[model samples]
Target: MPYEVQGVVSRAKGEPVSLETVIVPDPGPGEAVVSVKACGVCHTDLHYREGGINDEFPFLLGHEAAGYVEQVGPGVTDLAPGDFVILNWRAVCGTCRACRRGRPWYCFNSHNANQSMTLADGTRLTPALGIGAFLEKTLVHAGQCTKVSPEAEPAVAGLLGCGVMAGLGAALNTGAVGRGDTVAVIGCGGVGDAAIAGSYLAGARTIIAVDTDDRKLEWAKGFGATHTINSRGLGQNDVVQAIRELTDSFGADVVIDAVGRPETWKQAFYARDLAGTLVLVGVPTPDMRLDDMPLIDFFARGGSLKSSWYGDCLPSRDFPMLIDLYLQGRLPLEKFVTERISVDGVERAFERMHKGEVLRSVVEFS
Candidate 1:
């Protein structure tokens, strides 16, 4: 039987999201219905509300979520009801070229529920990042649901589904931070802080956090940044030079641009040592164009220039490892959850986020 539940929806850009009656269909082939426990208010959600993501109005707004499996479709053999799971957007299709090449993280064809969850009036709703999770229950491909330790807190565990995972994966997977490596992360938001923490976890000896926000800098310190640069008063060169000075006058081995603007990307481009890596984990806007590019600069600055997608995470692999680290007190996932909020508080959370008021305001469902 199909279930009807209240879900947050963006009826129009720049309009407040409301609780709408969403019709969730019974699981079809390869799908599962998850009873969402908690979801995080990511920048992507705000982008959806602002129509920054698309014209997909009446969008089912949340994606960073953890839940319990309520039902599994006919062909879904691995997942079963009552399983504790973290919902992920990327469900790699094995036949894709990326997956065939064994790089499932770069899978060109990802899967979602074949059936659509609709509005009460039968209007189809577009799910955010292919996983609409801000509701009481959501339908998703079974592959989107990865079982994790039931002991983990829903709020913190759900974060691994998005920003936090992106940052950590940027450093550990993309940047390949190693023992004694000098790493610098630009922007000290939740993602940036997570990169710093990931660098520390990967055994980086010097993790430099650069941000204009003093409060965010403080947060970065708790995430294991050995040094912080207040970029507000300093120009980009000054900030880069300061980081270089901190890294023994040699630029860091890896520099991550968590800010995602062209200015920050350029800063990261020039801030790393010769042959060092630069990982762009921040999302970029469509209108933003690169300028003043010299082909010589690209070649002279050798090493990988990469963008991290969902931290290149395979939920089945990364989530449990991160949760274990969290449980063991090695990773401070709890520190990232600055505030716990109810589902109705999402818009307000975005307001606070824009004001730089919180690291992460997680929505806890009763």
Candidate 2:
């Protein structure tokens, strides 16, 4: 029987999302039906609502989620009912070239459930990031479910499903930040702060956080930032100089541009020490461009300039490890959840997120 549940849906671009009836089908071959326990309200959901992702209308919102496997279809043996799991957008196809090369994290053929959930009227709804989870239940490719320690709180663990994972992977995987490295993260939102936390956990000697908001900077401090720079009214050079000043007249070993704007990217470009890595974890609009920088600058700067995709994470490996760390109190995953809201509160949560008032507003399912 198809399950009838309430899910947050964006019926049109720029319109407020509404709680509506979603009809989820039983798991098909290689699919699973999950009882969603919690889902985080992320900026990406807002982007989808505003049609920033694509013209796909009536999107089933909410992707950063954790849940229990309620049922698994045929051909699925690794997961079973009652398994607590974190949902991930990337479900690697083992036969892909990236996977054959033992780099499944870069899998070119990530997958979602073949079947689509629909509105009561039978209109197909696009699931946000392949996992529409704001409701009480969701359907996903079995591979999208990464079982982790059930001891971790749903609100906290679900965050690893997206933004937080991106930030952590930006430092831990993309930047390869190591002990004694000096790191600077620009943009102190959840993603940026997660980079700071990852840097701190990796034993960075100095962690400097740069942001326009003093409040966000303060949040960065709690995440283990050793220094803070308010770049509110400062020029690019001014921000770079402040970071250099904190690093003994040299720039940081790794500079992460979490703002993703051209200006912030430029700041990160100039704020790293010679041969230092620059990691871009922030998402930029399609209209944004970076053609003005002198071509010679790219040659003169002799280090890797990389963009992190889904934090370049391998869910089956990273998710369980992160959950273990969180359980051990070594990782402050719980700090990322500013508030737990009912499913209907996602619209208002977007306002709070836009105003930078909260790290994450998670929707808890009863």
Candidate 3:
């Protein structure tokens, strides 16, 4: 039997989201039903409501979630009911070419629930990032459920499900920031700070955080940034030069563009030392086009120009490792949870997020 659960949904473009009863089907083959304990409000959810992601109306919001496995479908052996898990969007297929090449992080095929959760009117809702999880219960593939230490709070563990992971992985995985390396993260939002913290974890001696907001810069400092640049009073070149000045008048070994925009991308391209890596983790809109780049710039840079998808995370691998770090007090995952809210407050949380008032407003389910 299908279960009825309350969820946040955007019925139309630019309209206010509200609580609605969504029908969650029972676990089918290779699927699992999760009793969501907490879910975080992310910018992507806001983009969906604003019609920024696509024209998919009546979209189910929320993806960064932590929950307990309520039931497991037939042929699912790795997970069972009572398992505490953080929901992951990327459920990698081992047979994908990328996986076969030993690069599972770049898995071309990921998994989601075979079943659909729809509205009372029977309109199929597109689950944001294939894991709409604002509801009290959500259905996803068994592989999407990554078991973590239940001792960790859901509010904190769920973050690894998305943005935070993106930031950390951008630095640690894509940027390959190493011990004593000079690292600069352009943008001091949650993702940027995560990159800073990741740099610190990777043993970077110097980590520079560049942002326009003073509050966010302060937050970056708490997350291991050795220096902060408030870019509001500075031009792109000025910020880049300031970053270089802090790094012995030479650009950093790795520069990450956490704010995905053409201008920022260009800045990141030119902000690094010769042969330094540039990692773009920010999400760009469809209307945004790349042009006017000198083809020589790509070759002249002499290093990788990469975009990180979900921080190129293999959830099964990274989630547990991050959880262990959190437990060991090495990663301050709890600091990212700026506020805990109810599911009804998601719209207001989006407003706070847009205004840069909070890092993450997590909706805690009773």
| Per-model CA lDDT versus the true structure | 0.92, 0.95, 0.91
Model 2, 45-143: lDDT tens digits are 999999999989999999999989999999999999999999999999999999999999999999899999999999999999999999999999999
- Residue range with the least summed lDDT across 10 consecutive positions in model 1: 310-319
Clashing pairs in 2: none
lDDT string, candidate 3, 6-104, tens digits: 999998999999899999999999999999999989888999999998887889999999999999899999997999999998898899999999999
Candidate 1: C-alpha lDDT? 0.92
Runs of candidate 1 with Cα error greater than 4 angstroms are none
Assess candidate 3 and give its TM-score to the true structure.
0.98
lDDT of 1 at 232: 93
Candidate that beats the other on lDDT, 1 or 2, i.e. the better one = 2
Model 3, which residues run further than 4 Å from truth? 290-292
Q: Given candidate 3, what's the lDDT at residue 339?
A: 96
**Highest lDDT against the true fold, candidate:** 2
* Residue pairs in clash, model 3: none
Q: How well does each candidate superpose onto the true structure, as a TM-score?
A: 0.98, 0.99, 0.98
